[model samples]
Target: MNTSRLEAFSDGVFAVAITLLVLQFVVPDVQSGKLLAALLGQWPQLVTYTASFLTVGVIWVNHHTIFKGLRAVDRTIQFINLILLMFVVLVPYPTQLLGRYLNSGFNASVAAAFYGVS
Candidate 1:
């Protein structure tokens, strides 16, 4: 198997996941005078976005570092990389869930745990 294609696919998945993170943030509707307050209330979304973005960045960096030392791609190596990429691609799902349920009591904890696990 060619490492080039695998690397390209992994890069595409990372890019898409990062792009999806911003899509979770919707504009807050509020009275004209309360715009600042409404924006301030979105701290959870902002925090999650920042955290996920950094996490993906670190993953990409590490992926590059790991692949750089590899002599060639093999079935076992490809399978391991696929597993890592699978989790990388799933990051946004939990991030979106956490953002949506961050203030919903029990659901918030569950979402946070899900995000933590992912």
Candidate 2:
């Protein structure tokens, strides 16, 4: 497979993923006076969004860095790279999970554990 195509595909996925991240921030059906406070109250989700985005950005940079050094990729290498992208695509679920349940306490710890593992 051509490296250019791989990079392009990865870039597309990353762009889509980042754009989709904002969807997790649902707006509540409350009065305008309460809306600002409600949004602000979800500080944990905001933090999760920032952290997850930075992590994804760093991984994308690293992927480009490593791929730039490669002369060619065989079938096995291609599959490995695809597997790497598979994990990349799965990031939003955990991000949303942590964001949605951050106030409950358990999610943050689990998120942190997963964060460390990731």
lDDT of each: 0.89, 0.80
Model 2 agreement with the true structure over 69-108: per-residue lDDT tens digits: 9877788977888888888777887888788777777767
**Candidate 1, residues 44-69: lDDT per residue as tens digits?**
89989999999999999999888777
Clashes of 2: 0
Model 1, which residues run further than 4 Å from truth?
Answer: none
| TM-score of each predicted structure versus truth | 0.89, 0.85
- Model 1 misses residue 117 by how many Å? 1.5
